[model samples]
Target: MKFVIHDRNNAIKVIDSDKDQDSVVKGRFVQDVLYELASKNSMEFIGWCHKDLEDFINHDQLNSIFHHELIMASYSTTGDYEIPEAIGYIENSTTFLNVKPDVNYPTWLMSSDIGGMHAMVILKFENLKGSTKTSFDGFLNHISKTALSEGLFCYSSPGLLKKDSVSIESRQNKINLFYFVRHHYRSRWLPLLFLDYLLYEK
Candidate 1:
């Protein structure tokens, strides 16, 4: 099978086979396409690789460049308003699992309740500049047609109001937390104080 994801003027085609042996190839193709999209847009693509997820969660040096708070927020908000039908679609169809982040670009995966083996994509307009709910809906409609042509299922939830804006002020506030600890904690009890602040304040 083959699927194409259309993003504005750009379209990405991903090829896969129905055979089980070709599953690995299909997975790699999907990853490559997703990575290309992310790179082209100056974003980051984090897939379902266990090591990658562990490294991202544990603050491993390999993926240390990503903001910890931003990642946590993404995880927390991804399934905030999931559609009930999405679980059925995911279980009965082939749905991709991945995290695509570009500073403020709001794209998240809504996993199924059945062991989270499948997920649907949820996109928000607030993360998109100069975009409205209508434009976003149109984009999804276009992609759904392409997905249908390739014998695949593509689902997205309705666009909702922007809740978390990752504006400059928010970024600065997160940065200032580290700076405050660095400048104020200078004594032997500094580690304790910092730990307390992280546990209580954060």
Candidate 2:
């Protein structure tokens, strides 16, 4: 399932999904989109690939708790094919935006918009609902305190909320997902770090 994230700092930067806004875009449309997003949001950009995840873990200098495996990667780009419109939400003041990822080929996927001063990490897993509540709570506890305060919301065949077990119907039938937000800048990576814990235990 995808989490549709919205950030006040980053609105949906419209891509000319149509012609006319044509630029020599190729290879990494996702990166291009991300860079554009970062530029718009005025944040530094770091585009990590599948290989980067593994490589970062092996490197000594970049010994970070954050890794690539914890992130949901998207393959489709505007460079290879037509890039479609991306819709993200902005919390009333534009501080928070829940941007759910669009579908990709073969296996469905999700994405995290890690821009602005805040970092984001989106994790995709199967059978989470069927899993135990302790499993989820463990994930919530593992992340930084700031993330815990912001809490999380689950989205799926029927959207669910962690704060309140409310199920909202979603047009997208196949994906089920939730979003955990970390409001404190210092603990931003806590949610992403907990991803490995969730995958291993559940």
Candidate 3:
């Protein structure tokens, strides 16, 4: 992959053939400037409206960051209910939440990815009989309700819902959903119907 770096005046330019396609040249540079500026100014760098990191990121990068935040923020709500673990890791970093979360954890939501609004939640059904159903109907109902009521949506993968999870444990179960939200950027992966519901409700 070829990469180009240009100075503010367009007088200085550097090229790199080794830079990856997803690499962020402008973002890294902007981040450095924001950090120095914030340090000197004594304020938050990434979240600042005047110099928000959102302004510096491209769509693809923003999407990756959004996904990262969704996982992180959704992490906080995991195992919140009676379940032992609401979300479980699949690959080392990739996780599986039972249902969707109320919030999306964005990389830029807070100072660092780890410190940001990483939330996870488990929903437990009480005094329930029969196996906890996680079929299409149940999943749709839960996701729709959340989206309609809270302006949240189930993140989407290419062919299926973005939720990562497993079957319920006994009559006691946790509905796991993983999500993250950032203040500025919106992901197309979000539940569009929910967004419509929110707009209409308001």
Candidate 4:
């Protein structure tokens, strides 16, 4: 598994050897780079666009920044939700009992809503292999369980469908799906925090 980080400009910021395959290692590397950028008051990195950190200081400021532009740009340019030629692809299982497996799983974290700083993780899988419905069920169970443990809502969409469907309604449906998922899962206080940050400051 290769780990590479790129900015909104599509410029490579960091690339590590296979030795850094651990998610924790990759996360730390990304955090280090983010802090480095924040220290310089630089929003050149994609992570800085999501939130307003005008009065935030040091580490707190770094964590608050989640740029929406970065997510849109990356997904629009390098992301291959429908096609497997670019970043990767997640297959759609036809039967309820089968779960497709992929050779590579690529994950990204970004904000899904416009002008909101909440973060969502997107995972894409490619070169799907055999399937077991039990495994698929387990996967969903695990996602739901993990989301509950973390106090966050987790949802999965059919990557193939998103690729094939291009209607405006389809796009809106996707957004709505996420909206409802978050609406049900998130605590009421989360929105209040965002509102406080947006309305009172600057």
Winning candidate number (TM-score):
4
Scored by CA lDDT, what does every candidate get? 0.27, 0.24, 0.25, 0.25
Give the winner by lDDT.
1
Candidate 3 residue lDDT tens string, 58-156: 323223433442221112212232221222211122333344443442211111101111122111111111223332122222322333234332332
Each prediction's RMSD to truth: 19.7, 18.9, 20.1, 19.4
Model 3 ranges off by over 4 Å: 1-30, 48-95, 99-202
Please write out the lDDT profile of model 4 over residues 128-178, one tens digit for every residue: 112222121122222333343454332222221223222211012222333
Preferred candidate (lDDT higher): 2 or 3: 3
For model 1, residues 48-128, the per-residue Cα lDDT tens digits are 222112212222221332322123112222432222222222133433344342232322222111000011221221233
What TM-score should be assigned to candidate 2? 0.19
* TM-score (all chains, Cα) for each model: 0.18, 0.19, 0.18, 0.19
Candidate 2 residue-wise lDDT, 1-202, digit = tens: 1111222122232322122342322332232333344344432212222221221211221112113222222221111111111101111232122333232122112222111111232111121223333222222212322232343221111111112222222122111112222332235455543464365534
Higher-lDDT candidate of 1 and 3: 1
Against the true structure, candidate 3 reaches a TM-score of: 0.18
